[model samples]
Target: MIPALFDRRLIARRRRRAVAAAVPGSDFLVEHVAADLADRLAAVTRRFGTAAAIGGPTDALARTVTASGRAERVIRADVFAAGPAGDHPVDVVIDDERLPFADGSLDLAVSGLALQWVDDLPGALVQIRRALRPDGLFVATFVGGDSLTELRAALLAAESERKGGASPRVAPFVDVRDLGGLMQRAGFALPVTDVDRVTLRYATPFHLMRDLQAMGASNPLRERARGLTPPSLLARAAEIYAETAADPDGRVRASLTLVSLSGWVPHESQQKPLKPGSARTRLADALGAVEHKGE
Candidate 1:
């Protein structure tokens, strides 16, 4: 069996704490992703009878879907309740690894900044595909690619210098290239994947760390170093971060690569790729060029 990469319990605890604290501006990414999801849903002309918003840190996703009038009903599901909900309350507490929905029940499923934490991402995607009705659409965005590269570098260098060794501080993120294949592996038809890069500037490295903690996005890797990070290590990391990642304005840049994935449940009516060697027109004829034969 494949081992878990993240500590689920710790993730839940951190998320719950964030919700309870209600840190101001901590959910900026959630809001940004919610807006992006809304825009994507708006592009679709057809309305969905039922939809599920999975793993949203806030009710932002559900609210956005509801407000779009694209989905008649939106079921909000998360690992932990993100405090009292807004227009749509938390319908089910769920682990991304296991969904509770019945097969072929949902017309749409949307998630924002959540699937990256799932241990079995492919399995979770399979479950999502199974839960969707024929031709049902799935759209999601997650942190991926070279996210937090500067922080990872700074932490590693600092820890190595101060403690003689370094441990994993930032969680590993998926590369954009692999997402489309994952969608195909999960049996989704017409799968599409793209990346959206967002760069945030911070006055200092410590500020960035505090913001991550507020967002419950701190390291949750199972192999992460135990116990609190040393103050001296942290200080050194801050120094290194400023020195290496700072711009002319003296603020450091942090990169966030949001990988967007969209696919549809297979249906007989959906378009399919033409079989190999089935084309009526030759490529040479279409291109107005002669075909060459190799000896």
Candidate 2:
């Protein structure tokens, strides 16, 4: 097996903490992505009778899917054993890497602001694809490579300047360009990927860090530094961030790039690409142009 890149236990603990937090942290991003996913699903001509959302902070996606009336039922699953019960309740708590659904059982699958933390993304995608029936749809959004660019740069610069080196503070995210290929590799047909860049302004880098902690999005990389980050390092990083990333208003900018991926299971009813040299009409004839052959 591939060595784990994220500490799953730590991730689960942080997630539980985020769930219990009094403040609403990072739900805005999750809600935005969930609404976008729901809109995409609404646009589809086909209706899904069953759907599931895997490992998201809120049940927004599941509720949207259910409210669309396209799906008869929707379920939410996460690694954490329990969370705040809401209108859209979680039905299961299983590791996303090991989905419990049976093959060909679902008509749709959606996730919001999740899956990026999974150690084996490709494997998880394959499991999702297998769970979907033929012609079933899959849509998801996760943090992309461009997420937290300012913070990453500031951290690196600060650590290099003070400690003569840097440790992994930000988790590596998937690139949008690579997602389509991953979907195809996982047996998804007509795979598509796009990015939604959301930028927010913060008063200071400390505020940004606080939000990350509240959202349970703090560094959970297996190789992350074991000891407490020196207060001086954080102070220097905040200074660097303010100097380099702050706007004229004196607020620092942070960006989250949500990479949306969509695909469907292949079925006989779905459209297929035409074979080469199978055109019904000649392009020259249609365009009223002469065709010249190679001499």
Candidate 3:
């Protein structure tokens, strides 16, 4: 990914964390998932000895590589802070989607926790596929299905109990089953996709929401609510979440589903139709023989 994008994103995430640092919310969940994603990428780095790594400041993902004590000769790139592509000694550069490398150039590619933030997931996947040489592989994980289930349920229930309808929409997630197909459609071979739902209990909805903001996962969607939420509405929403979303022991449960996918660039797959009109047998001769036998 382009270093400029990474730099901008880190700056933006920092700003977002600063803005909502006081209000503990869903950002916390995003942070946890992001960290997990980073760690996953770092593992790939360590194992494959990929030339470079890319990520945010608290990049335990890349640090996972260093922490493993493998001590390979690898380079790291901030992608966001990178002034020129490949200028950094690191072979992998993890920024947002805008990959800086040329097509079919990378040996291994990974992205953690950030693919969910992209508007054009398919396009990005295609680009990633193109960046790899034949048989080169890409692995990534993103937020999907049933995430923030409790928050969504509580808010919807509260809205129903209060206004007899829905409030502003909360975040939405992609289902895992659908994303798997997307890999095949993008021309990736042996595509694999699966989901992991990490459930956590929160003391309060307020705390849940606080964590959300810290991860720079605020509602960036254009169709978000226009007007401010009324105090009564928010109070009722929190009440409903606390009252209804409690687990057996009463900690409200929230889940973050990480959908992981892997795909390989087709190495030797058939891409063309069979040579045209190779058969020379005549249909008329066969019909004549059948007719004679009937006689």
Q: List TM-scores for all candidates, in order.
A: 0.94, 0.95, 0.67
Candidate 3 at 290: error in angstroms? 38
Which lDDT tens digits does candidate 1 get at residues 1-295? 8679999999988988877778889999999999999889889988999999998678899899999999889898988764555422488988778899999999999999898898888899999999999989999999999999999999999989987888999998988898889999999999999889999999999999999998888999999999988798899999999999999999999999999999999999899999999999999999999999898
lDDT of each: 0.91, 0.87, 0.61
The TM-score ranking, best first, is 2, 1, 3
lDDT of candidate 3 over 82-185, digit per residue (tens): 22332223345444456666786665666666666555677778877877777676767777888877788877887788788874456566678788788988
Task: Give model 1's TM-score versus the native structure.
Answer: 0.94
The candidate 1 region of ten consecutive residues with least summed lDDT is 80-89
What is the overall TM-score of model 2 with all chains considered together?
Answer: 0.95
Global fold similarity of model 3 (TM-score): 0.67
